[model samples]
Target: MAQVPLVVGLGVRNSIVSALLGKGSEKFNYLHRFLGRSIFVASTLHVAPYLHKYAIDDDFVAQLGKPVISTGCFGYIALILISLSSIPVIRRKAFQFFQISHWIGMVILLVSLSVHVPICLPFTLSSLSLYFLDLLLRLLFKTQNAFLGTPAVLLPLSDGLTTLLEIPSLTTGWRAGQHVYVRVFHPGMGLGKMWESHPFTIASAGAEGEGDGEPLRVFVKSVKRGWTERLFGFASDGEVGTGEDRMRFGGAKGGRRCRVLVEGPYGGTGNILFSSFSSVLLVSGGSGITFSLAQALSLQSKALLGLVRARSIDLVWIFQSEASLQAFMPYLLPLLNNASSNKTASSFKALKINLHIYITRPSSQFAYDPSLSTTLLPAHDHLYIHTGRPNLSDLVNAKVEEAAMEAKRLNGRGVNPCGLGIGACGPQGLVRSLRNVVGGLKGERMGEVGGVEVVTEAFGV
Candidate 1:
């Protein structure tokens, strides 16, 4: 029974440490760092009592006179220095020196902790078990591509954004809206050297009858500063040189050169084709449209397979500029055309996909069509173009509610009141906002209406 609290406390500490090391989002990283400091405090508290007991009851002071005790004491002092140096004030004084010393202090801490806990069978075994589990998980991921027989190909699109990639091995076929983990391999950089690998939707796959030579595509956009930027470099072009020189210099040279290791095509906006819902509403911000684009393509392909029938798909992509759309046109144009042609042939029965591009930062070079309006959209749906960054959550929520109301007005029982499945991929804050909006509506509309689903993909930690 006494082990219960200890287990719970250790579990909490483990969670905090894991979050600090896990991939995805700056918010989580900040939380991890904060919680790591708390763990240090807890660890200190845990060790203090044992030390006190040894000193008072066991006359451990006599043992302290030994050389080993002197070494351990110095090690503990170094750990304190490292902790203190992590404070902003001290770190700012000598950043490089502090970083090197921090590593050294970590070595001392690990050695001291091992010695301090040695022969304590329970604690040592527990720690070893956790360590081995982590190692096993890493090993599994490292060999994933070999077992899956897929090679990850990264393509750097212009506009300083990597919006496309190909996986040659996933020829068994991947569904639209499914995401995979990508780890960049940098030679001479050592194993597991690739920083945080984030999830991106498989925007489009090769034709249904296509061979294994065909590659799966993934879309990505760059954030200000993060692990993605560190590994891939800030510039998307091939200008970045390989080897240590590149890491030292930073940024790509002529084109983006990065090797990626992919793992698991997991979780997405629920299987759209198999769902009973007839309509889908896809609302995205900036590069967040990746998953939506994939889903739209998936639904079209599934319809061709004669699997399920969906009424219409309304896609709203909010971007900072028209360039974003044009930049991704190589991938988007085909999907759009297919959806359009299929809708016409089916007499707008099986599936209808309409694209609405919202330009938040319209430049003087690009002119807006005066005749183009949101009302220009079809009777059951429409395309909306905005000049500036519109509130994505508000727009999506309002659109969903409007679609639901329209469905009810038509006495349609199959249409979900929550509207359509919403899949988003982009920066963390934007994703969080969308999640909150979805969460708020989960009980009110989403729970009762089986039509809508929300899927999100974040960049990195």
Candidate 2:
């Protein structure tokens, strides 16, 4: 019974210790997420034997008085909190709650398990050490402002749907697809105020900024009841309507800027896509584009500078409306203009970047019948928006097959097998779908499609 918890303890370490494991040496591939179910099973096995013994003995109530029993109870309680909070429905509905529960549960498990089981003392120490290391590193690399960290100015759009943030003093050493945790304290910091922080991907290409103290830009959606809502609530007081009536909010207009704390640029270091990959596919949905845009630009820069292994780049972006596209133009324009530039090496003369956009719910004028598959007016560069949700499975499956065939053709020339890297960040369902598709494609055709490498961007942590 005591040993069962050992597995649960090890699994917990694997899940959260990545923050301490530096990215340059140990890039957390998120391979340990499956440990959630294993930890739950181990927790059940560890507790069931004790519960069975308790049921047969009338002294079970008296046994609760024992310090060991009471201490063990906390470990059980933490397990329950983690198990229930990890449910997909609960996790998706209230991510912040799940995050808090998991954190508290981990602390309880560490402290209580150490008191209950002497052997667990080392495990607790190790986890705590890693936790402190992560915090210390965050502070070391954290951007510094005049007073606090960074002064992030939030500019809410006319529609009140999106906000463009201009953040000063962004931390250095951030990779293309890395994200930062932001804690927004409206009207600057104050005592007794509850702080809510969320992880948002750095949207702009050089969001780390160049030289001394350039500003980093990112887009935040004004989701209802989301942390962003409270951060932008100051601007919501004035008149609210679509069109130019409201214009953009923040900076000069109304003058609202919030002080924020930024932590980490976790997951992969430097280049997101492994430098060895020949072809790269970037998939994004809605704000997930924040993860893809910077990566795409980095790949372009590498290809243009004659330092890239990837020749073909396919970017698949899905959105709800054209307004969303226009709102993101600030980040996307640089990539497009650079890719379409006339100057560059002959080898860099052509970058095979095929951009595909899928719009789920467009304007009233656009025809969309749910009964039909899709109503797409596919064009060259500016493809017409699609009417329905994307069939992600079919799309990825086809790409895998196509990449495999191309790799086989290149193998005859005595060249090494071409590698395909597929990276996606989006809604949970979409990210899960991409992961499923990638998992299903693994070990196909004698491992021939050169090699298919997949990286999923998840905000679950």
Candidate 3:
């Protein structure tokens, strides 16, 4: 008999049930909330089993009078409030009021849960670690916002796509390919001041070494009736309007700064490239190439500074259309030119970096010469561009396998070297795909090769 998946066997059966029930349009957000509730219920059950085993014999009710137990009681109460308020019935009945209360209840739950955690030093240390991580990301975000000079700014990119943002700072340096969270306040929509935040990669770090102190640039494609359009198309200037206002005007007037909360320079592992890997293969979809570009530019910069040694770097950027490439050109051109010039000047084995642009959608304006070498010259670093979107799962898996094969090829000659580490920053689906591919490669070898390591950066939760 085939063994059941560990997730189902562990009693976390939601995934299995969802698959059996047909993962149709129940909405993922709702499913997420439901899963959270289920986790909370499971935690409650764990406590109950212990309570039942000890309560009768030890008089646990009397022990509950202790401060820790009292705090846990408050936590339980807060959880109830969170659960009840999160219910569709309550939310539908009084949407606005429920929304307001829900936030407050979540805050209370977080606080109570923190207190309910064990008072042991290890627990405290773990809590502190999370707190510091949040704090550091917040600080970096705030600094970026301030340097931008306005709390926020809304503008259009090359295409009709719009981006609404607030940056209190822009002077704190940001590497290329890093992303920031964008929050949109739309007036008179659904509920009031109900803002939605999402991550967008920095198109360019904004004219490196140029002392103008301008805001960092980001490229965003509007999707249906979402927060980006609401903020970019509606919000009034300087009015602190509701979601409705943002949906109408695209921006507020009178210098009312966008109030943005920034978080994270978090996940690009720069150390991977510094290792003894012979070559680097970077695969990205849509705006996901921003992180790869940043690494390439950083590597070029390091080469310029005579910092480290590397063989070559290859970049594969895949997007839906030529328009997407055009939108990214303002940022990408400079980096490419810089790398090209650096190659010309360096005799120290030029770090060959090749860029391949793959446009999935065919358009008259998007055609490229087929003769273009994906390789960076002098070192003959290979660059291969293929049109059409590669299945993300297949691409990740193939890359892992290829890296292992190459490692084995080198190892057969008695020159075993660490394989390239894959890094990606993208949407949930892509990140999840890459993560799975990485997990599968861990401890698996190709031929006589060493293993492959993958690094990823995911936004929000």
TM-score, every prediction: 0.63, 0.74, 0.58
lDDT of each candidate versus the true structure: 0.55, 0.63, 0.53
- Model 1 segments more than 4 A misplaced: 1-38, 48-115, 118-154, 173-178, 186-201, 205-214, 220-260, 266-279, 306-310, 343-350, 370-384, 406-420, 439-453
Query: Candidate 1: minimum summed lDDT over ten consecutive residues — where?
Result: 1-10
Q: Which candidate is the best by lDDT?
A: 2
RMSD of 2: 6.3
Ranked by TM-score from best down, the candidates are 2, 1, 3
lDDT of 1 by residue, 237-270 (tens): 3453365543332222343444456765554443
Q: Give the better candidate number (1 or 2) by lDDT.
A: 2
Instruction: List model 3 lDDT by residue over 1-461, tens digit each.
Output: 01111211222212333335432112133455655577468658856775786566897787677767766666667667767776777765555455566557545645555666554334334434444554464555433443332355554443455443434355346655456555543343235334554567664443345333335545455656655555444432334555564433333242134545444332235344433454466666665676676666666655654653345666777777666654465455555566657666666544666676677886765445546533221112243445777766666556556666666676788777566656666565777776776676546453224545565654323
lDDT tens per residue, model 2, 65-181: 998998888888997898799787898788778878978987887789889978778767766765665556556754343237577666665435766666655534666776666
For residue 391, give model 2's deviation from the true position in Å.
4.3
lDDT of 3: 0.53
For residue 238, model 3's alpha carbon misses the true position, in angstroms, by 13
